[model samples]
Target chain A: MMKSRPIAATLAFVAAAGLLLSGCSAPAGAEAGGEKKLTFMFRGGEDEKKAYEKAVEQFEKDNSVDVDIIVTTADQYATKLKAAIAGKEVPDVFYISPGDVQAYVQNGIVKDITQYVENSDTIDLDNIWEYGVDSYRYDGKRVGEGAIYALPKDVGPFSFGYNKTMLEKAGIPLPDKDKPYTFDEFVAAAKKLTADTNGDGTLDQWGTGLNVQWNLQPFVWSNGGDWLNEDRTKVTVDTPEFAESLQWFADLQNVHGVTPSVAEAQTLDTYQRWMKGEIGFFPIAPWDLSTYQKLGFDWDVIPYPAGETGKSATWTGTLGIAVAESSKFPEDAAKLVEYLTANKEAQQSLVDAGIQIPNLKDMAEAWAADTSTKPANKAEFLEIVKDYGRELPAGNTFNAEWYDELFTNIQPVLDGKQSAKDYLKEAQPRMQEFLDSANQQAGN
Target chain B: MTTTMRRSRLHRKEHQAALVFVAIPVIGFLLFTLFPLIFSVYASFTNWNGISAPVFKGLDNYTKMFGDRYFLKSLWNTLYMMIGIPVGLVISLALALAMNRKMRGTTFFRTVYYLPVISSIAAVAILWQWAFNGDFGLINQGLSLIGIGGPNWLQDTATVKPALIIMAVWKGLGYSMLLYLAALQSVPRYLYEAAALDGATAWQQFRHITVPMVRPVTFFLIVTSIIGGSQIFVEINIMTPTGGPEFESATIVWYIWQKAFDNLQMGYASAMSVVLGLLVFTITFIQFRLNRRNQFSID
Candidate 1:
């Protein structure tokens, strides 16, 4: 018995460690390894994965190189990517964000690709959204000034969508396509539509169900309030206009009764309510199109309700296709990025999969002009993308800690426990500290 | 003389084999655990952004932790959730006492209690998240039967910690109970009989005999529970992705993780992690120091 005990114990431990090591390495599979191999990591849903798989297959065939696709869910992608980078198994090309450009450039994690784009005959710089392209431009001192580190994957305009059936049922006129509703008019409509449809002594339908994080930008911007000033050095969210806009957003749920309460929202969130035709309005991004296409209710897009400025405004978001600086084949990776971002076929496939609007202006215009889709006002998304859709304030800053601070304590305002003015007054200085630290970190 | 010489040689061979066996795990421990521990200490004093080279920052990251509201709040939240440890132990010990009896269907009840322990924490967290939904949740529906409206468990700042505590206690009850059960079985029956023979009242005999018998298990459970409680993260991330309502549910680890990956503040996170490691080590050291006087060393 003693003779075999050591072997058995050692074997058991080896087996256990083998399991752990194998499990850890399992997700990092390189399919059909070859001399010319490239790894592309990106985050999205099943439809997006399917779409990318097809596009990647075409790119591989065209380039005569092996491409390994690593698809991760949205929530876990950032963590997984960071782990990969830290572990020194960095993917050749991955989705990057503008907000991370300064730090990424400083770290040499991403390669500068200004020369590749300038030399490529297939890519027309003007065809891509200028703002989207500029978001990835980092000059070491500023984000949007110098050489490019990544190419825009897609410039997604966060559009406002409303339920047509609910509006019609409430005898409310449909929102105009070109013009936005004034805050008062929007509230009036919301109040009109928020009634107990089945007379169960409970609210089953609400005019709007907006999550503050994703939906408050339009109101704040339209009210002539912004998170940062022109140079992006100072936080300027403590203004009276910002407070008034924030108060109005809070009043939608607390005082106006237009939105679902915190308790009410905990059951079926605002997004679910919108899908079920219970909510009048919700924010819609291009990435949401595939999932939202399956919604039971008929919905259409509109500009968000205007505030004090009488102008519609909202944020545009984008993910950049970045080539890793440590890649064995950076030029190949850069070519793949160029193809993904600028190629007509790849952009069309992504759009056809309902994941995004086309990157090319000509294709986007043609796609928006088509009226057969569920959202008849596709032109509104186009208009926002083409004209007034501004980058989120976080995109301009060195880091988003300062941007994220604004919402950390703002729940009290939404809960009616704190006033917007007092909250903003306290918030700006705290944000400034993070901003200052971030600025210092960036050596600004 | 030949047999003796052969036996001694065999002994030497066995000793070498034993050393080899011990060395495998020792090497792994040193490489993975010891190396990381030492590296993190060095990293805590530097402005390492996890991408580029690190710059030395002296005590900046460490000193900054005190003034960070998020860090303080998260630390408080982590400690607040540790309330579950004591509550879990008490209930589990009581359960162990009850289950020690020759009862019907004891195995089934044991399995039922332990099911949560074996289940994946991610799945359990997701299930609890659904159950704690304010309006149409199982918890609120149960409360409605009693005509008492339950506040939104995971969303409301007042209840998020309590909700997490309740879940932690529930999930961990069976493991501690199992340990206590084992300890109870191992206790000699003679002590109880001797106590009863001395004309001791039921309460006194039970208290003196049973409680003393189970002291080792209690010590063990408390130390481990505190260590586990302080590092709580996965549930907070799963249930409240934005760090709960007003950041009430965010634990120290979750905040560290957010700062590291989300904010790209790896230096700050590494410093926080060092503090957490030291705190956990100190607490564990204190427990060991106190327990050194007690009987039944873990080794």
Candidate 2:
């Protein structure tokens, strides 16, 4: 009887713990509102949230549909989205980066919105930038060939922002509007601009600052070296053009000593240094316009320098809005996406706030020509978009894996520990194997 | 007969009440812990991308680990970080002994030592990242003042692990010290007195009495510390956003997290997690056996 008493107590404790835990695992469901509710998830900061909130409010009033918005930090967005998908609670409309669009589409999480786009009387597919529209198109074998699954939020063109004051102080002429500096000219200008302002042995100002992963695209693409073959079936990182571009980029830090060392860069990040007018040329996107407006020095942007091919090349960063396949109200979600991406008012609101470039081709020219905007030469962004811009290798399903591998392995080469040729040579076969496997898995 | 029946009825009521009390927790355990564990084990054998249905892949996921350089490197990094555990234990024991004495401000000292344990890991990692910065950092500035050039603690491959270990040890010291203090306080004074009566010195008494008496506490500390140390994630994630300069600080859990969440390779991550679980289990089992053998020897 005593043993029974202890057993009963143990059972009570276990039962209490189990009940509490079960409560924790209770399934999350959408609120049962009288009006049709649409859930939208996005990655952004406070500014983005504010812009989205205003747009969503307008959307709700016009359509009489309720929107449940979920905003998460950029780092947490992917994990949260995956969890939502796994739990069968995916948002009706969600932001999908170009890098993730292929995988999401392949996994059957994104709905094909081609028919919706064609049927919608309000949406003119021709008004949107081809790059933005094509970013979401994915055939079984490659991108830019199949059904459109999403609409781009913006066309983020990477251009070079230079401190005009620094150029004037160095007695160097500003780069020509149409013809920016060639690779040699850019390097020479950078060398001349590099200075030791405090007369200390150490340099207080640098020629430029660039992230190997984010800013290297211009150099690689300008050199006519790409991450994948034309059809995206294989990795092509072992070519001489790719190796030479990587080496030249690294030499800007190691051999030329123009840029700050990795250790020095860690102490004060390049963004802060750029704000302090310490860098001569730094990569800037349209989104960074507001931040740069606060900088005390005179600054203007130019297209990325011409490389060995004598052609300026750049990459466009695109984030698209897609309807989830599991959405109960996919039609409504598609309408929300159309309103967010195709509506002139919504695009203008984002552009006027310096949040993003216009997704519509017609609006981009006017937005860039707004002289009241900072960077005085905002038109260069449009030039890059219309002429030299291409989507990142991540546009393909398996290409992001290859891209990440390069970024991971290229650190040694950038640090001058290994030659670019040797490193890429070693990594090429492994990358090819990975891409082959990904293709096989996709039955391509 | 009526009294016996009354007692039986009361016992029956008590039993029912107890069953009702425990039912919630048992159901919770079955739903959250047990179910997820079983699902994850099953998932380890499949190729699930979290969004799509899992497809059985037999031992493919497990076999991939044998050739995965990053996985092997992360395992090494995890074991490297465990070096901090024993070092932390010794430092905490020493501090606990000193603070356990009947001195003025003992409580204040105890509180000060326990502060890090209560503090948030994200805040601590960010603070330490600045302190460990190669240039314009407090640590480097101090080192330069003493005629020593500090290496780039977080960026350099050679020093990144040591930097992480130092941070881990510092963060863990408070909790370890409090545990040791509790164990120290419970040690009977009679054993020490007997040792003193035997003409033993202070060190001799401490060695003979305090050390042996704290064996069980030490065993508990080592087991828990090893488990916790192997799962180091937050500190590395915040301090080294790219997994350190050359993947120097990538631990097994961090790798699993990256694979599962960042790359969407949930099944592969589950397989790696299962392997990690086995590794931790083996180490803990060996420690338990060693502890038991030591106890038997003492008897």
Candidate 3:
């Protein structure tokens, strides 16, 4: 009986200890047998998952290390990643969005890979687009100026996806794919393309749709306006140029009645409407190519319409692969990041899957020339990236919050409940306050 | 001496067995519930961003709530949603009373009513969203058939709260009805018979006898409903991504989730959670006192 009691007590203690330690134990992929293991995490759709799985398999076979690839959906990625970081179960390598890079770097959750990149024999830093690389660079105070913390997976430039069938049905000439339309010309074309085909009092079809928050950069930037100055220490959105551009964008839906109302858009949403051949033009990116290929209607790509400045501009959505600072094998993780990003063969597989554009400057031309792809104006994507693509203001810390705040307040302006001038006048100071605090925190 | 030693050993063995049974729950309570509660309370007084070490900020997080428009709006929205509790109780009790009588297919009807309670919140919210959609929703189509133009139920700020409240009441009706059904079954049949002999109508008997008999159950449902209503998050999150057009449908718990997870403002979120906890506690306490006073008055 005495022997049994001690054994039972010891078993209970061990069980309790196991329960507690399981949470904080080594990574699930850590050092199986003699092979060192790497935990890689990313978020994407099924196509991206398949592409990444192939790449990981190749990487594992060549490197003699076991790689555990964790894939999450886009919606749950941020929350899951944050929870993982807080719980100290951070993946050795992960995909970081431009908006989150600053926060991750500021918290020292991501390792600085500048030294690793410089020391690598296979990677040529200059071969990648500077803006794409700059999105992940942080110098403690500002982005675009210091140590590279991540490698760019893709540089996606937002452009116009126009319904060729709809334009032809309206007997309207297609806008030049190489040279974008002037603002007035675009508006006129949109008005001509819009119609109420069923003879109902309500308009059944719209010329274009804009996701006020995501698609605002084209108008703001082409009109020679910006959210922040070069240093990102001040808010530049209060200028007359910005307000006028914003007012013009809102007028397309309100005064012009070319775009669907907020409530009407909720019925089918812009993407669905575009797929149904209802919208004349909608924002498109490289990642959307796979989905767009399934559309039955004739469609083509075009540059964003130019503003008074006669310049076309849009935001680039860049995804970067970063190494976790908590990783024990930072060098091995760096090697994996390099293989996934800098290796042309690895990128070509993803590119062939229509999930990404080539990150290498020279390779993009060849990739664009491949006639097997959809959106016949594929060359225009490269032109926009090379000529006019700008990083979203979200690349800066706290700027995303201010950007969201602006969108939240500007709804009234778009609904025609308030004027843009009055709204911007009231909003500029609040935005500046956010920028000031962020700047101070960044030691600017 | 040998017998005494054997008795002591048996007692020790029984005591050990009792401890083994108790230890599992004690460890769970400490590790899962108690630890998080204490840690969250501490987190409320700091400025932790989930990634960095928390900096002690004393009363700053608490004071900041006063100036936060979103926080105040969420609190008001939460209280506004509690309107569903009373309305839900009345409807459920009426159904319960009707079903408690000699009725055909009582089990079938009860199962039908309880289906929504068993269904996942995500599924319910998605179904309700489709029904409440502005343009192509079922509700608007029905209204149009009646020559009435339905307002945008989910999009417009003015109508969003009522739409959410209607959903909450519908979702809660089944659970509340089951509780009332059980309570009504327990009421003495003699009381109703005696009342009927006194020529009391069905309404009078229900008002005077059944209501009083079910008061304690009613109190239980009310307290739990209030607590549940105040923490409404999933429905609003699924139905309205931006908190229903300018934060109109934002509940306190939803706001806390956004702050903690979305904005990484864990400390501020924790502070708001503490406040919500206190609010629930105070309300429950007052409810208990009121119920006690009512019982005394009845006596």
Candidate 4:
């Protein structure tokens, strides 16, 4: 009887525990105003997260809609985003990068915002760059077939930044701040800056350290060669222009010995290396300026040198705000997007964080001359961007593979184990094959 | 008759209670592991990218794996670690043999050796990164003192894999040694005495008795170590961000991680994971079979 009593008590305890776990009340806003709660997840560090939260707070104040902001790490954000989409628990408003826009559009996960953009009085469509909007567009429209999935909220454009101290030490003439160096002169100056300053048999200082992964695409684009054709259907990377650019690129490491091997560069943390003045010439994006400035180096931004293509093209990045396809209040979500992104306060907050360049033209000019920066070259930085800017080659296929694939395929050439001609020839077919398969799957 | 029948019913209830306790855990096991495994198998067949509806990709992922150069490279790298880690296990076993003897400060030495096993792998990986740095690392400084120029440890392709192997061994040896020591103590001493009675030397007795007695532990260690070593990622991730100066150090798990997480190719990554799971299953199954078939029953 005693044993039986304990067993009975145990069963009762288990039942109570289970009920305790299951019977917990849901949060107050879980089901607000009989409308389903929508979540919006984004990747940002502490300050960006706060800025976004502030925007969300303003959004809630303006509209009678509930928005749940889920913050994730930049490293894990894409995976979680994809998983959310796959699981059909997509947030009402979320962020997308240019690299994965096509996949989202094709998969019908993102709600097209074209009509909303045109109809919504709150959103000034002209405030957004046409090219930036068009980059998200597919099938000759700024949105999915007739739908707009996302709009650009912010932008990041690449610029050639140099260490003035290193140039002075190497007896190279300081770059003309007003008139930036041309392409040939940039290469010549890099060579002059390369030196064995310590009198050691090995070189002590390198003139430049090209990031083999994220930083290489601009150089490829700066040349006439590109990863894809105009239609984004085929890979045509092995053109004569591409070969010349790659050879010149390879020479920075091999012939001139001005930069480290592609392998060494892969392992090198470029910004940190650049901060210590170990690297002289760095072609970096605007977001990197915060780090560069934070490092307190004597640095200046200059326009990227032109190739035979006769125009400079720098890789640009945009933060995209997308609406989910399955949102109950697509209209409300669109309104929230409009409110959060177009709000002047929101724009200013993003600028203040230095997370990205403001999408609104009017707001950007103010960030241009914010003299609070210690370097005091804030005006020049904006001018450099104004003169030479192009968006990163956007497509469905531009992915994490964007860096790894290019690095792996092209690294052999730098090692002299394979010729540039052979490497590009092999890479073109392989890249095209990936593009074809991915696009075909996406197109369906 | 009513009382007897009631008591019989109560006994049956008690038996049922025992069954319920066991069945609950089994049910949980079925739900968590068995169900997910079955779902993963189904997922492996289809092109499910997580967001969109899955399409039938029967045998396509499996077919694509064969032609995947990176996948093959990863497989090779994983196998390299499998081979290297066991060499470490053997050294650890040798160390355990020495420690198992009643030596001075043996308890203290055991705690010191086990320190790394308890420490966070993130901390270990970070510490090793500095130690193995090519130009300004402490390891090169020590090597220079001995008049031997240390080759670029983490930077060079040839040395990167070896360096990781060394780190893996160092990190794992303590745990493996403890396992061996425990097994060694349980081994009967009479067997050793009998061998010695037959004019056997210390080496012969160790070879004949100790080796056979510890065969089970060796098998256990080898199986678990192979699984552990194949999934090596943190060291490579921390020390060599791009899987070393080249793709030389990229392993299967890291490659899968890059594909799924970095690229947002969840479908492909899941498919790769399925393949990896199968490969591990096959190897473990084969080792289990071999161990069963060739049991050295010294007892």
Candidate 5:
């Protein structure tokens, strides 16, 4: 009996120790058995996932080390990335949106690639847009000084994409592609589009549908109302301009009864609505053109309407490949990042897939010329991005939740349950407090 | 001395195997549960963003929690869900008794009613989201047909939580029903016959015999449902991304998620979780006490 007790206790101790060792083992980069394998994480649907996989396959063939690719859905990306980073098991290479770059960079998760960029023969940092580079930089340090966290691979430029057939059917003159109608004229056009064709009590078609997501930020920016001040430490959304623009937005639902309430817009697929020729004008990213083509509507791109600020501005989402600081082979990972962004073939492949605006300066025109692009005025689409586009602001707290806040806070105002003034007034202080608390917690 | 030693040896030998069998799970529970519970209790007293190292800040999170509007709203919402558990219990028990009869296709009917409980919460939440859509939803349409206008079911503040309650009850009723059905069928048939022969009506037979026989099962349902209902999260999370129009449908778990992820206030979130756990524990304890006291009378 004594002999068995000792044996059993020893076995139990061994089992417990085994579990603990498994839990605390070194992450992927450490204790390698072969040519170090680096993980690249991204989020996309099947098509984009396929493109990324193809790029990774090519990268693996060129490098001695194996490249592992992990793809997450858009909704799960932020949550998973946060957990992975916190666990200190982050992928060696990953995709980070420009808005989230600051958060990751500030937290010391990403390695700066400045030194690598300086040494690389293939990638010309100068050719990359200064504005685009600025989006990824923090306090004058380009993402991780001497090591780039990521290189810009795709640029999602926001612009107005209109249904030419819908405009023609409604007998509304198409706005100039080069000069979009003024903000007032834009509203008038929308009002005309809201009219019922069947003369039934219900309107079968609406003038336009606005996405309650990130799309509304452009409208706020157009009115010269910023969500936060330049320092990003204070919220500045309760100003007269913000209130007026929101009032205009609300009028579409409440007084003018032209567009659906923000909540109703949530129900409708904004891209699908524009594609089906049910809506005349839609604010969308150029990346959406591929999906828009499936509807086969006679559509074209237009510059953002000139707001009271007079400068036409559109919000942009930038995508890039970043290297984790804890990477096994930092040099190889850096090279791969550079190759994915700057390699002519890879950039052409991305453009060919109609995924996004490739970073190379000359690749801008090729974005429109890729054989896969079926838009009637593809050049005009690229032109809109080149001529008038502003990258989205970056900060430590910039995330999907920011837009969710805007949507939820402004929803009642849009529904006429409250005035825009009252809503924005309440919202500004609340958002400010949220950001302040976040800043305090982050020790900014 | 020899006989006592022999008995001790035998006892130790018998329990050693049982000890070996339980050792892995016990260690796992201690490490994953007990250790974290202790660590989080320590963390709850600190100001932690989860990125940097946590700094000790005694009682600050708890103090801040008192003024948090969303936290209070979620507490009230949790209390409100307590009402649904009893409503769920009565309906489920009634259905169980009906289904316990020797009817044709009884198994098929049971499967149909219990299906929602087995389905993924995400799918059910999504299905309900569409059904609860303010304007074009089937529920609203049905209401309009019956000359009763549906208040914007998911959009309005007052109606949103009630809409979630209806969904929760619908989702939960099946499991309790299955439990009660088992209890009903297990009751001896001779007891009902004896009561009937003694001039008992159907109602009296049910009141005197079936009710007593199912008292234990009813007690089980009440306890499990209360515990399950208090921790309800997936429906509110999946359907109402922004906590159901002004945070009306925000439950305790949903509030914990918002605090941890959205705000990155892990310290505050941990404090809230401790309070919620205690709240559930206390409520369940009181319920069990009351249920045991009433068990004999009901039977």
Candidate 6:
């Protein structure tokens, strides 16, 4: 009996070990709730939460309904939100990305809010940015062209920022607002900005430090290189223009030595360097304004340096506020979305809080015209919005795997270990494979 | 007859109480462990995207695993880290011998050694992440004191795995040292005296007496550590989130987690998980057999 006891305990322990083997996740089950309460989940920082809380407070007061706010950090948001959906305990309204529209629609997770949006008195579809609104539209096969699934919470114009003080110190003239600096002119300015002012045996100042994921877009687009062909069926990153853009991006660090070396940058990343007046150029977005307001150095947005196309380019990032198809109070949820997205007072509060660009065209134009803001080139954000802002290449695809592939093995090129042309030659087939798989999954 | 009937009723009542006690673990074992095992086996053969109902696809996920270089790389990385297990055991055993002597501050040393084992892994990983930083990190600064320019520990593909291994060894030293200490104290001193009288050298006495005496504890630690080490995720997740440079530091569990949660490829992740399960079970089963044989031969 004693021998059997030990053996049986060991057996139980082994069986218990099996628990972790197969259970990928045991998402929390549904919790009890009141009859009329709506769950609103989103990902944001404290300022965004406060802005949203103000808007939602009005929403609850006007509608006489309860809204339970479930805020999460951006990193954990996707996992938690997906777990909720998979468990069939989805929130009434949640923030979604445009990239997931196909799967969400296929799974009946998102409701078709076309009627709600069209009939919403506060939400004038015509007044909102067409780029923002159309991102949620999907026909059965194509994205960006059919019934709307969600409303835009905000349209984030990814803007280029330059240190005004650094330019003044270097005796460099400010860039033109009407016309972007050519690539050569930008590089020359960057070279002048790069110096060892502290004499620490290491260069303390850098021209620019750009991450490939976010900052590479303007360079690629202005150079007439794109990740996908129009009609969105082919992987087109293997073009010479793309290689040239990529090599130039790398050359800023490897050839020109304008940006910080990898080892130096590891200690303090480019963003931190820019914050400390060590980096001359960085990317800024609407979300950064609240933090950037407290900077020790003066800075402002500029047109991205131009390439062969002779025009500035950047991508607009938008978060979609969606009502789940299974939501108990779809009308109230839709109203909240409309209010947060389009109501003048709500939009004004959000814009003043520096959480977003205005969704309404007239309000945005007015906001851009006011030169009192630190950016001083708010019109550049408007220009991108009205003319040059494009959706990221992944936004058009069924899944982002193909687009994400561009950066997965890009270190070799960026580190100057491999030529950009050689890297792209190898990268295209892999990207094509993912794109083809995505197509098949979408039943294309 | 009346007395016997009353006794029988009391016996039945006790039997029912014991049954209730036994049922909890059995039910948990079935629901949480066995059922998931069966369901995942079924899931491994499907194309479930975690959002929709699974569609059956025979042998595709398995065949793909063979060609998946990331899967192979992660598997290799996981096994490569097990090199630290034996190295850690050797060091801890030596520490255990030193600690077994009647020395001052043994308890203080014990506490210090075990501190990392008790510390929350997330917090330790964060501390280690900064400590592994190239320029300003604690590790590099120490190396610079000795006139060696330390490479970037976490960022460089060549050094990332070794950095992780060092951290693992340091964190695990305390627990193993404690176990070995307990095993050493239980060993009869007279055997060592007899070996000494027989003119056995200190090293020979250690090899013949001390090593064999601690064999069972060693077997236990090895079995448990191998199992525990294979499921290493939190440190990898917190430290090298994007799997480090060139995916060099990516372990099996971290990759499985990324595939399952981030990519929503639950079906493929399940297949990978089942393979890991089989690998762990096979290794454990072999160890058990070997250990039983050793015990029998000793007898």
Steric overlap count per candidate: 0, 14, 0, 8, 8, 0
Clashing pairs in 5: A112-A144, A112-A147, A112-A148, A113-A147, A113-A148, A115-A146, A149-A322, A150-A321
* Tens-place lDDT digits, model 5, residues A1-444: 555766567677777688677755457656446667777788888878887678778878877668777789876776777778767788788887665665566677888887888899878987765545555665533332233556776667777767788788889988876665777898788888886678887676777777545555666677787677766678777899878777877776777766653356454445455666677777756577567667767777777676677666776667778888878788888888888888887776776676666677777665566655555556654554465566654333544343345565565776788988888887776677777765554444
Clashing pairs in 3: none
User: Which model, 1 or 5, shows the larger TM-score?
Assistant: 1
lDDT-based ranking: 1, 6, 3, 2, 5, 4
The superposed Cα distance between candidate 2 and the true structure at residue A62, in angstroms, equals: 2.6
Question: Best by lDDT, which number?
Answer: 1
Could you tell me the interface RMSD of model 6? 8.3
Clash pairs, candidate 1, are none
Tens-place lDDT digits, model 3, residues A1-444: 663686487568758776677845566456557677889989998888988899888888988878888889786787888888988889999998777777788888999999999999758998888878888888876677799999988889888879999899899998888788998898999999888988988787888988777777888899998998876777888889899898998899888888876644353467778888889989888988888889988898898998878888998888899999988788889999998897878888898898778888889888787777688888888887777888877666643556656865666787788888899988988788766755553442
> B113-184 in candidate 5: lDDT tens per residue?
899999999899999988987656789889999898776677777888889889988998899899888888
Q: Is candidate 4 or candidate 6 better by lDDT?
A: 6
Q: How does residue B101 of candidate 4 score in lDDT?
A: 92
All candidates: TM-score = 0.92, 0.92, 0.93, 0.87, 0.89, 0.89
Better of 2 and 3 by DockQ: 3
Q: Write the per-residue lDDT of candidate 6 for residues A160-199, one digit (tens) a residue.
A: 9899999899898987778887888888989999999988
Model 5: CA > 4 A from native: A1-26, A99-103, A140-148, A261-263, A267-272, A369-372, A377-388, A391-406, B1-17, B141-152, B296-299
Q: Clashing residue pairs in candidate 6, if any?
A: none
Compute the lDDT of residue A266 as modeled in candidate 2.
58
Instruction: Please list the C-alpha lDDT of all candidates, in the order they appear.
Output: 0.87, 0.83, 0.84, 0.72, 0.74, 0.85
TM-score of chain B of each: 0.94, 0.96, 0.95, 0.92, 0.91, 0.97
DockQ value of candidate 5:
0.36
The true-versus-predicted C-alpha distance at residue B40 of model 3, in Å, is 2.4
Q: Per-residue CA lDDT of candidate 1, range A212-290, in tens?
A: 7877889999999998888778999999999999999989988989887664544346767787788888888888887
Give the CA lDDT, 0 to 100, for residue A418 in model 6: 94
Q: On a 0 to 1 DockQ scale, where is model 4?
A: 0.44
